[model samples]
Target: MSDRPSPGPDVVVVGAGAVGATIAYTALVRGSARRVALHDIDAAKLEAEVLDISHGLSFTPRGSIVGSDDVEVCRGARVVVVTAGAKQKPGQTRMDLAGSTVALVRTLMPRLLEVAPDATYVMVTNPVDVVTTAALRLTGLPSRQLFGSGTVLDSSRLRHAISRRVGVAVQNVHAYVVGEHGDTEFPLWSSASLGGVPVRDWSRGHGGRLDEAELAEIADEVVHAAYRIIAGKGATNYAVALACCQIVESVLRDERRVLPVSTLLEGEYGVSGVCLSVPTVVGADGAVERLAVPMSDDEQHRLRLSAASIRATLEAVGD
Candidate 1:
């Protein structure tokens, strides 16, 4: 490891796979953190990733990028993103990988905390809510300091699909995918908007209207886009890499931005104990508070079920 003088790595990524490498590149390119470290169990892969990242240093903002097979690189890290876990196979849901991921974290989290006990952890593995809940039990840190990269991507997918269908810029389209990051996830269509105008109002103004069926179709696409991508490319990485960058930036820069990350609920929306995706304000302090947006009764019911689903997986794989 190239020792940079004091104030060590601002970000350390565990797992040197496609997602991890992409996250390292994106974070440096975006200047999310000045010093970023990449660590993995495979020495050869970590060396290759380090060299690749080193080669591109001249093109990015002035920052140090290092990779290692040792978890020691994580020492003094401000944020450690855990993306090391088994990839989801074709025809599988994120929930299906729970056992393997749980096993992976059970081994890695303790080692990680040993070196970087103060770092905020960003859980990116599949079965994110379950892994996050398990990590919480293992680390016993403040709930705000660790969270899953939950349905944030699902919400992004929804916005993209809505933008495409409505011929609006993606940024102008506002939507959310709440509850689980898996099969039970649902779109908050009741309050979804286009530049602050409800979708219904926006569509009506444009001389068309989005009915329940159309919105549901878009939501369905958001929920299952991962399976399609994994089937096509063996793993889904690019969009998620960008999502992880956004998360790292939020903490590194202390941007108190609201995002839909998963944190253990203590009675939000009448749910508790389990960690599930919900709107949260994240900054240097990590997930600060979860926003309680209005949800229809059916939406609340489904959210509860989503929490229960993750809770069941957590119970099956004891902490």
Candidate 2:
């Protein structure tokens, strides 16, 4: 056996389920962190995940995995990912899991803060906005340091929809699904473009045009994709897990990347005290700034409604 104690992991993922395990796997595959510690309440599940991931570690880029149930395993982690709690099931929205998940977050958060107060907490559990808001309030961590894997996946779905309809590479499509990462989420169509040109202009150039009604339909599809995916697969994990990995990477590398992540609002979008997805500049210090991009009146109104819904939940739970 190696005599030396294993070095502290750069990232510690709480919850060793599909989402947490996939985040660890992706981090290792992408070489984002030198070490990843996975923790869960279930020792058997945690061990199984670790062994499975370990079997593949040798063939991938270098990284180490440690599995344990002790919350103290989170010590010295630069990025702490929270993927715990009741996962969404088919025919269920994230809100459906709110009460139970809130209880779960309340139970686990104090322990996490006690052990890894300095670590950036990335909320991946369902009703993520609510859980993330509760975490910020309970831990008294700076609001910016707690975030959710929010509309990033929704935005990706939107981009894919536009790409398929327009017959262009999704990379060339730049759109965002902002606001709540749930049924009420809205896409920022006014600012969407490609190569600094309007999407409509690009469509016209390609001998086509996506009418407002068609665009709304596409947005509806984006909003419902999670439900559709969950209905088919029984859970929405892989895409979200990948999104969490990306956010963790940004924090660990100090990559000042903009993502439609759920962050605390302090007067941005004319709202405060609620966590919602907005374009944010994220770095090692967590959400650095909220991007106050101009939006059409309709889009702005929808954003307000979404923010209001989140605020109501936060208040209802009295977090």
Clash counts for the predictions, in order:
0, 0
Candidate 2 C-alpha lDDT tens digits along 12-113: 989887778888888888888879899999999999999998999888888898989998799867888988888788888887788888888889988887
Candidate closest to the true structure, highest TM-score: 1
Model 1, residue 228: distance off in Å is 0.5
Q: Single out the weakest 10-residue window by summed lDDT for candidate 1.
A: 200-209
Return the clash pairs for model 2, or none.
Answer: none
Residue 263 C-alpha lDDT in model 1: 94
Q: Could you list the CA RMSD of all candidates, in the order they appear? A: 2.0, 1.9
How do the residues 1-319 of candidate 1 rate in per-residue lDDT, one tens digit apiece? 7687677699999999989999998898988888999999899999999898989899999988988888889998999999999888899888788988999988998899988988999999989999999989887887899899998889999999988877788999878888888998998888789878898676556645778788878878888898899888998889999988898899988998889999999998899998999889999999998998999898899999998898888888775
